[model samples]
Target: MAADGTFSPVPTGEKSPEGAIGPRSNTGQKGGAGALIDYCTVVLPESSIEDHGVTWLPNLIGQLFGTNGAIVVGSIRNKPWQFYSQSAVLLDREGEMVGRVGLGGNGSTICVSLSGAGCRWVTRWDNVAKAVERWRGKLSRVDVAYDDYDGECLDVHALRERAAQGDFASGGRPPMHRFLSDEGHGTGCTLYVGAKGHKELCVYEKGKQLGLKTSPWVRAEVRMYGKHTALPLDVLTRPLDYLRGAYSVLQEIITGFCTRIRTTRKAVEATGTAMVEWMHRQVGPAINLLREAFGASWADFAEVHIAREGHPGRFRGVAKGDRLAQLMREELCPS
Candidate 1:
C-alpha cells in the first residue's frame, strides 16, 4: 500500500511472487552471447544504495535493449549512479547520482532492482536484431558460476547440484565458466550446467572448446556394471533382446561403447577444465579397450602392410617363419 490509503498485496506464483524483487525474468534463458544477460547486484545489509560496479551493465543492457537505448545522468538523493530509465538509478556509496542509460528506444520496457549502493536494470528489447548486431561483437566471455559448496569437494553430486541450479555461463558474461563432474568411480553423463539457471548434456572432446550432445541411449560403465566381461552371445539372451535377437548384443555393446566414447569426447572438448578428475579416472581403461579392438580388427592387415613396403612374391608364407629374426637382423645390419 502507498502512503495514501491504497491497498496492495504481493504477487504470488509458483516460481516467484508478483511485485516482489525476485531474479531477472530471463534469469534462466539461453542463447548466444548477444542474447546473454550479465548483471550482478551486491545488496547491502542496509536499505539504501551504496557503491557499485558498471563493468557488467553495458553488455547486460545490450542484451536487454538491443542497440537503441540510451543512458541519462542525474542526482538521486545525492547519490552518484547511472540510470537506464530516468526513474531508475544506480547508486554509488558516496550518494552522487550519474545518469539514466539504455539502448535508446522511445518505448523500451525495463526491469530494475534497488539495493544498498547497488542497482540493476533489464531493459526490454525494442530492436532485437539491431541489438544483436550492435552488441554481439562487443560481448566477450561466458562466465560460469556453480552452486555453493556444501562442505563437499567438487564431484558428480556437486555437479548434479550445479546442474539443478543451472550454473552454466549465460548472457554474454565471459567464457571462463566452471562446473563439477561425478566424482564417484562410475560412468555417467557429461553435463554443462549454467549458473544463472541453465543445464545441458554435452559431448566435450579434449583440446576443444564447445561441447556436443551425447546419444540418449548410451551410458557410462561404472563399477556397478561389474567386472564380469560377457561374451557377445551371453548378452544376447532374454531381456537383453532389444532388437529382437537380431544383433541385439551388438547394439547394447555399441551403445555402451558409444557412451564411454562420448564422455571422453566431452572431456576433450572442455579440455578437461570442467571434468578433469572424472576423465582421468575413466579414460585409461577406455583407451586400452579401443587399442585392443583396433588391433584385433586389423590383425591380418598388419602383414599385408609390411609386405607392401616392397617384399613381393609369396610374402605371407615367407614372412611368417623369420619375421622377428629378419626385423632384428635388418636393424643390426643397418640398411
Candidate 2:
C-alpha cells in the first residue's frame, strides 16, 4: 500500500520488459518514439479478448497487466452498467497501484489513467477519432469529466449557461445542460449533451484545494460515459471486444481533454509520434482487422502530427531542438 493508503498491484523492483514502450521516468524525456513502438509491440499481440468466464473485479484486475495486456473485469450479474478500472491503474514494481483510476456508475464507463509523461504521448483529437470509430455507431451518448488545476479562474455558471445555449455542442446542435450540484456556482463543473441523442459530455474538477494561501495544482477528471444497449453484459465479457471498445472510448476522452488543455509543442510532437508509431506497430492481422472494422489507415495518422505541430500561421518555419529533431528523423527514417 502507498502512504496514501491506496494499493498498487505492481510488484516491487520489477523493471519493464526489455523492449516495453512508454516513458520509464516521470518526465518522459528518455524514450521518444521508440517507447511507443515498444509499447505497441507489447500490447498489440495480446489484444485478443476471450470469454474467461464470470469473475470478480479484483481477480480480473490482476490479469490486465504484463503479458496479458488489457481485459474486462467480469461481473456475474450481467448488468447494463458494467464497471471497469481502465488501463490507468497499472501495478508498480511492488504490485502497488500507482496512479489512480476512477470508479463510478453509469450506463457504460471506460476509464484511462494517464501518467504525467504518458499524458504527453497519448492524448490527441485524431487519435481519439480513430479509437472511437468502432464503437461510434453503437454509442448513444458521450460525457467527459476533466480535472483542471492550472489556476484558470473558471466560472461554472457561465459555462452552464453556455451549455444551455449549445455553445459546447458541435455544428450548432444544442445540448441539454445540467449542474452536478445544487450550488449554482461553477468550480469548473459542467455537463453537455451530445448532439447525438442520448450522448453526453461531462467536464469536472478534481483534486482538492489546500487553503486560500496554498492552492494545489488541479487534476482534471475527464470521463467518456455513454449508453450502448447493443453491448449487453454478456458480450462485454469477451476480452477482445471489450478491450477494443474500451480502448477506443478511453483514447477519445483522453484526446479530447488534452486538446482542450495547454501543452508544449515538444510534448505534442512526442505524443503524436508515439500515437502514430503504435499504430504502425500493430500486427499485420490486427492491422487488417482494424482496417476492416473501422476503415483506419496510415493516411489518417498525418492529422495527428499536423495537429501537434499546429496549423501554419504568420510564422513560416518552427525550429526543432536537437533531441526532438533526432526523434523525428528516426521516426521518418527508421533504422
Candidate 3:
C-alpha cells in the first residue's frame, strides 16, 4: 500500500503524557546504541469465533502493547497469506503502522509481525513477553541486530575471512555463506551465513544502504526462526547472547556474553490456557482440513462453556468485565 506520507500521532496530554513514551536503549560497542531486535513475528491460536473479525485487532492492541493509540487497519492484500486474511497495521504512539496483524488463517490462527520501528516503539519488552506467555503465543521469527559504526569490531570482509578460517564452523560443519554486492552501485554489500533456514546471520553496510556512501556503519544481525524448530523466549530478554551464539565468529566479537548453547523450552501441560493453544496447534489442522474439504457448515465442532472468566479487550465486544455473562447466553452458544 501507499503507506508512506504523514501519519498523525495519537493525541495525548493529561490522560497519557509524553512521558508514557519510553526511552530507547543504545547498544553499539562504538558510535551508537544499535543492539536491537529489528523484526519479529508472533503467532497466536484463535478460538473458532475469535479468528475472524474486524474488531479483533482493534480491540486487542491497546491491551497487547499498552498503547492508548486507536487502532487503524489496512490490508495484507486481497489474497490470503499463509492462509490468513483481514490483516491490520499495528499502531505506535505516532499512529504509524509499525507492524501488521493477520486473522482467519489456517487453524484459525492470527499472526503478527513487527517491523524495525514497531520493535523499537514497544518499550516494555517484559510486558510483551508476559503477554505472549499469558496468551500462549509462539514467536515464529525474531531478529536481533548490532550495529558497528566504525566497522572496527565487525566487518563483512572480516566475517567472510572468518568463515574461510572455519571460525563460523558449527558442529564441525561450517555455515554456508554467500556474498552479494550491487557492484559499485553504492548500494553496499552483504554477507549472509546460514542464509535462511531456521537460523541465519547477516552482515551489511548500514550507512550505504541508507544512502550514505562514506559511512563506516556496519550491522551484524542474527535471525532465529521457530517455525520448524523450538525458540525460547529468552531471546526477548537476552538478545545479545542469542546473537553471539549464532556463530563462533560473533561469539569472539561480541564480548561479555559467553552462553553459546541453545536453550530448550519446557513442554506445557494441557491446562485451560494450554488447551486453547493446543486446540489451535493439535486440533486446528483437522478443523482446517475439514473446512477446506467440505465447508464451514460441514466442518464444525462443539465448544463447551466450561467456565466464565471476565477478561475484556482480549476478544471483540468484550468491554471492561461485564460481557462474559452475556456471551455465555448469546445465540452463538448451542443452547
Candidate 4:
C-alpha cells in the first residue's frame, strides 16, 4: 500500500524498471566471496507471494542475517494491501544501519531493489560460504562412510571369498567380524561389527558395461543405516562430542542386536530385518541427543524414520513420512 492509502499490485515476471530503487542488479552473485553483494530480484507470482506470507520474508532475512543486520524500515497499509521495506542497513558486526534495501510496488506486484553498495555492505562482514554451509548442514542427514580397504580393488566374489578367509581384519585395519550376509541381488552384502564396535554393512557390486577393452570395476559402499538426524551447525561444528554420543548410541544398538533378532528369514529378509531393527532403536536416543543439542526447533524440521516390518515407519516429521518411506523402500529394494 502506498502512503496515500492506495493499493499497489506486486509486479510479476518482469524485471524492476530502470532507476527503480533496489532494482535487481547483475553485479552481485549468489554465493562465495561476492555473495553478500549479490542482489536477487525475484518478481513472484500471486501464488508465490501468498506462499511466502507477509512476515516470512522478514523472518527469513532475520534468520540468515542477524536481526541487527536487517530491519523493517517502513511500512504502509491500505485495505487488502500492505508493504514494508527490509533494509540491509547494518554494514558490520557492530550493528550500524548504513545502507538500505529498496522495496517498491504494492500488493499485486512488488519489487525488491538493492544497490551495489547495499549489496557489498550486506556481505562485507558476512561469511556467505560458511553461512550457507551451516544452513546445508542443518538440512542434511548425517552419514558415516567407511573405506573397507585402500589397496587394489577386488571384485565382489573375491571380496566375499577373502571375507570368508578372515582376511579383512588380519592387517593393521580395524578388526571386522561379519554377522549377516546377503547375496539376493547377485551383489555381495555383509554386515560387520568393526573393532571399534561400530556396526556397518558393506554392499559390493561389480560395475558392468564398460568399453570393449576395459574391465568393469568393482564398486562397494559401506552404510550405517541408523538414525537419520539433521543436526544444527553448532552441534556439527563440534563433532568430537557428537561423535562420542553417536558411538555410544551405535554401541547400544549393536549390543542389543542378538536379543532383537530372535527369529530371522533367508539372506535378504534377515539382513533387512536387522537393518530395520537397528534403525528403529537408533531413533529415540538420537532424537533425545539432538533435542538436547539443538533444542525443540530442530524437531519441527528434522525427519526421523524407524523401520517397521522391514519398511520405514514414521518416528518424526510425519508430514514427510511418505517421501521417507519411498526413499527407504527404494534403498532396501533397489530393483
The CA-based lDDT of model 3 is what?
Answer: 0.56
Better of 3 and 4 by TM-score: 3
The better candidate by lDDT, 3 or 4, is 3
Stretches off by above 4 angstroms in model 3 are 1-34, 48-55, 70-72, 75-78, 91-97, 182-186, 256-335
> How accurate locally is residue 101 in candidate 4, as Cα lDDT from 0 to 100?
33
lDDT of each: 0.27, 0.31, 0.56, 0.31
Worst 10 residues of 3 by lDDT: 261-270
After superposing candidate 1 on the true structure, give the runs of residues whose Cα lies further than 4 Å from its correct spot: 1-36, 39-120, 123-129, 132-137, 142-157, 160-335
Alpha-carbon runs more than 4 Å astray in model 2: 1-63, 67-147, 153-155, 180-199, 207-222, 225-335
Q: What is the lDDT of residue 302 in candidate 3?
A: 29
Clashes of 4: 11
**Model 3 Cα lDDT, one tens digit per residue, 23-83:** 1222221111224667888787775225334245655665555445534446446555556
lDDT for 283 in candidate 4 is 71
User: Candidate 1's residue-wise lDDT over 1-335, tens digit each?
Assistant: 11232211122231212222222232222211111122222111111111222234544444434323333223323322333224345433233332233322223322233221121122332233233333321211111111111212223444345435544323333223243343432233344322222212221211222222221222211100111221111111111121111121112222111111222232233322323344456665664665587777544554554235433222221122344245434433446
Best by TM-score: 3
lDDT of 2 by residue, 205-257 (tens): 32111111122223322222233332222111111112112222222222112
On the 0 to 100 scale, the lDDT of residue 194 in model 2 is 42
lDDT of 1 at 158: 44
lDDT score, candidate 2: 0.31
Per-model TM-score on C-alpha atoms: 0.17, 0.29, 0.61, 0.21
Which has the greatest lDDT? 3
